[model samples]
Target chain A: MIDWFQKLGRSSLALFERLGRGGLFLMRVFAAIPSLVPRPRLVIIQLYSVGVLSMMLIVISGLNVGMVLGLQGYNTLVDFGAEESLGQVVALSLVRELGPVVAALLFAGRAGSALTAEIGLMKATEQLSGMEMMAVDPMKRVIVPRFIAAIISMPLLAAMFSAMGILGGYFVGVGLLGVDSGAFWSQMQGKVDFYEDIMNGLVKSVVFGFVAAWIAVFEGYDAVPTTEGVSRATTRTVVHTAFAVLGLDFILTALMFGSV
Target chain B: MIQKRTQEIAVGVFVAVGLAALVMLAMKVSNLSSLSDQDGFEVIARFENIGGLKERAPVTVAGVRIGRVKTVIYDDKSYDALVTLSIAAKHNQLPEDTSASILTAGLLGEQYIALEPGGAETMLKSGGEIKLTQSAFILEQMVGQFLFNKAAEGTGESKAAEGAGP
Candidate 1:
């Protein structure tokens, strides 16, 4: 019993240590925000790498997901003799939930992992220490731009995903299934509420972007300067980002759609 | 300098695409396109029950949509749902005595208000109250009543006689 109690206490301490470190790192990022403002060029470059580079993955995933949704939604709606409502189902599912969630997941995998790997590699090369030796704050020069770029890009990527998803749904529903395009669009227009569906998804994506970027950069910056450590940090960035996105999604959905 | 210019162009394209996506999302989600009924006049309708009736539900006349539901308010005094509709100006020729009924698009699809014109000379002005309104069809209650009636019939005339046993 004593041995078991000792193990539990040690694990709990480690967990608290990680949480405290993460909180402090977040505070440092916040402190370094002004450094990013005067340097639009840095932010723009990071945005291109993080946001623009991730576009292809987001669009492809969104299209496939929406196509599948169209197929499945059409089948289900047909059973109720309401196949005309395929557009509403497709648009609702994408705008309210899947677009944000899928974009975040893809963003974590493509951009977040890349951020972690790049930063981790820099740390492994003693470049971060080199910057410190040169009297430069690596947090401002290195981390803040990437952080700000990521946060800005996410909602935009999510919107693109939603738009492409709608198009994919249209192709499947209207082209293949022969659903009346006019009815499909009109029905969707009538049913979907702007504030409730679209804005809610945007808000979710923004929160997710902040969390994912924070995890990616922090894990990278804090990684031990070793090959194994860099790889582990990259992996952890993806894993942690996925968990954070899903957890935040559930809470946001509850807050947005639930009777709160 | 050329490299910087190229990078700036790429960033410009990226920002432009992002803005396009934003506009598309906003238009689709909010119905903010040219087709949206921005300039519309208000009208009121009262119903005993507005089951599954939501704000922004279409108000159609003879299957052509002319307006959208603006709001749904419950009047405690009469226990009626007072639905306000914002109709496009082009559909301003509806008679004052026009009747409105809540109808489903498909059998189990969304519900909307269907207006039927009456043979009245005077047209309804903006903000006119549509006095004749039918409530939405409650499928569950209808099904329950149907089952009850079927069970009663299965038991024959004895159940009916028992109910009239005064």
Candidate 2:
């Protein structure tokens, strides 16, 4: 029993330590934001790698998600003789819920893990230390650009995902299932709102981007400078990012949609 | 150097498309594009019940949208639901006798206002109130009313038979 108590104490202490470190890391990143404006080249490179490179994965998953929605939504809507509202169902679900959440999850898995691994490797290789020795702040030169790029890219990725998903739904619903193309488009047009559905989704994506990216960068920076430590940090980045994005999505959705 | 330039261009394109999609979503999803940029005239309508109708719901005339619902209010003294509509300026020729009805898009879709034009020469200007209006038809209320009437009739018949017993 005494051993158990000691273990509990140790874990709590470690948790507190990590929390303090993370809070400081986040502040440092925020403080580095102004430096990005003067030298956008650093930020743009990360954007290309993180944002543009992930496009292929996002597009593929978006298409598949749409096709699945079309197949499932069509069958269910047919039961209620609401086959014409297939577009509305697909569009609303994608734009309001699935698009942002799934995109963030994908972003976390892809870009978030990569960010952690890359930074972790840099630390392990003494490159971050080398920058310090050269009197360059690694926070400004390394972490800030990636963080800003991530926030910029997330909503764009989400929009593209939703747009592609809608097209996939159309292909399946109209091309294969023979749902009325006109009604599909018209119903979607009539029901979906700009402020409520699209704007809220964009906001959710941005929030998720900030969170997921922060986790990735922080995990990398905080990891012990070793091979095993870097690998562990990468895995933790993805896991933690996924959880944060989903939990935050729930809270934001309620605030945006729940009669407020 | 060329690779970097290409990457920059690609990012720019991606951002541009994303912004366009956002605009499309805003306009199409909210159905804001249905209303033109032209200024519209605000008019008032009162109903005994607005049902599930919401503000920003489209106000259409003869199956064509002419405006949107600007506000919904409940009159304290009169105990009636008041709806404010903003009709398009170009379509400002709605007669004073024109009637307004709250309708659904489809059987189980969103509620909207449908205006039926009347054969009056005078046009309704801003702040004009549509006198003849129909409230939303709720299926639940109709079913409740029907069941209640049937039960009442059955009880009444039983009472009459007992009173007339020989």
Candidate 3:
């Protein structure tokens, strides 16, 4: 009983320690924000790696997800003789839920992992230590740019995903299913409110981006300076980011959509 | 790194594409493009019950959309629902005696305001009250009234039979 009690206490302490450390790291990154503006070049490079490279993945996933939604939504809505609302059903689902959540998950798996690995490898190689020795704060030179790139790229990527998904739905819903193209578009426009649906979705994606990026960088920076530690940190970044995105998505959806 | 120029161009393209997608979403998929800032005249319509009539619900004339509901509020003095409609300036020729009715699109769908043009020479101006207004049809209320009428008829029939026997 004592051993079990001791283990639980130790683990809880470690978790709290990690939380505090992550909080401090986030503050430091925020402090480095003004310094990042002058060095757009660094951020651009990071954006190319994290954002540009992830585009193909986001777009493809969005298209496929949208197509599936169209197919399933049509099958269900047709029973009610509401096939014309396929576009509205698909668009609302994508914009309000799937777009941000799925995009963020994909981003976490792709860019988040890459960020963690890249930074972890740098730490393991003592590159961060070397920079610190030269009086260069690696937080500013290294972490801030990548972090900012993640934040900037996320909402844009999510938007693209939603747009692509809507097209995919259109292709399947109107093109394949012979649903009237005019009805499809008009119904969607009539139902999906800009402020309530799309804007709220954008807000969700931004929050997801902030949380995912913060988790990725923190996991990497906190990684032990060893090869095994780097690998573990990369895995943790993806896992942590996934959990954070999903959990935060629920909270955000409730806050944004919940009438209560 | 391939080249600084190449990297910047790629990033720029990515940003551009993402932004374009967002614009498409806002304009095509959503109703943002249809949301115009043109000046419009406001008209108030009083209804016994608004039902599911919401703000931003399309206000149509002869099945063609010309404006939107600006507000739905309770008029404590009149003990009725007051709906404010913003009709587009181009549709300013609507007659002052026009009748507004709360209508549903389908058996069960969103409710909107429909205007039937009245045979009048004067046009409705801003802040004008539409005297002829109809409340939304409530399915449950109708069903309840129907059941109540049936029960009352059944009782009346039994009472009539008893009097005839006596």
Please provide TM-scores, in order, for all candidate models, with all chains considered together: 0.89, 0.93, 0.95
Pick by TM-score: which candidate is best?
A: 3
Across B13-118, the per-residue lDDT of candidate 3 in tens digits comes to: 9999999988888889899887883478899999999999989999999899999999999989989999999988888898889999999999899999999999
What is the TM-score of candidate 1?
A: 0.89
lDDT of 2 by residue, A1-260 (tens): 99999999999999899989999999888888998788999988998889989888988899999999999999999999999989999999999999999999999999999999999999999999999999999999999999998888899889888988888899999999999989898889878877778888888988999998899999999888999999999999989988888889889988999884
Candidate 3 DockQ score?
A: 0.86
True contacts kept of each: 0.53, 0.65, 0.92
* Segments in model 3 whose C-alpha atoms lie over 4 Å from true places: B147-166
Candidate 2: which docking quality band? medium
DockQ winner: 3
How accurately is candidate 1 docked according to DockQ? 0.55
User: What lDDT score goes with residue A147 in model 2?
Assistant: 90
Expressed as tens digits, the lDDT of each residue in A1-260 for candidate 1 is: 99999999999998899889999999999998987777789999999899888988888888998899999999998998788888899988999899889999999999999999999999999898899999999999899999999999999999889989988999999999999999889778766777778788889989999999999999999888899999999999999999999998999999999972
Error of 1 at B11 (Å): 2.1
What TM-score does chain B get in every candidate? 0.85, 0.80, 0.89
Residue range with the least summed lDDT across 10 consecutive positions in model 2 chain B: B29-38
As for model 1, its CA RMSD to the true structure in angstroms is 3.8
lDDT of 1 at A230: 96
